[model samples]
Target: MVFWLVAVGCLFVGEASSSDNKITAKSIRVVMDNNYPPYAFLDAKGNLQGILIDQWRLWEQKTGIKAAISGIDWGEA
Candidate 1:
């Protein structure tokens, strides 16, 4: 489930030139809910964790795009 969502999200990053199919940028900013468990949360070391985090890793590996992932409380998400 999370894997599909992350994969779809990667397709819509829109940091590329639609007309020419050229990349315009290589970085993305993402905010995940730290309050959610197993889906999104912060680890003991203050790093993002859970299924979404792992999926993002795969997304970066396949697309060569850099994502600056961050975690915030539910209210912010």
Candidate 2:
């Protein structure tokens, strides 16, 4: 999934952003489950953690673009 996101960013960076009828920015917005451990979870320090965060680091390294993540309830997903 991380690879796919990076790929999509690389392949169609401007095209999709331009077509979307929403706010536009150079960064990408991503939402994740707040309590899923080893994937994405809130830490004791109230920071994002787990394997997905590591993956996101790699994604940012490869894509050279920024990603903003939000943790929210699955129902809100």
The numbered model that scores best in TM-score is 1
lDDT of 2 by residue, 1-77 (tens): 99999988877978877787764456898898888888998899999898998898788788777888888877886
How do the residues 17-75 of candidate 1 rate in per-residue lDDT, one tens digit apiece?
Answer: 35557675698988888868898887789888899989998998988999888888878
What TM-score do all the candidates reach, one by one?
A: 0.67, 0.63
- State the lDDT at 30 in candidate 2: 87
Give the lDDT of residue 61 in candidate 2.
83
Summing lDDT over every window of 10 consecutive residues in candidate 2, give the lowest-scoring window. 17-26
Q: Report lDDT (Cα) of residue 55, candidate 2.
A: 90
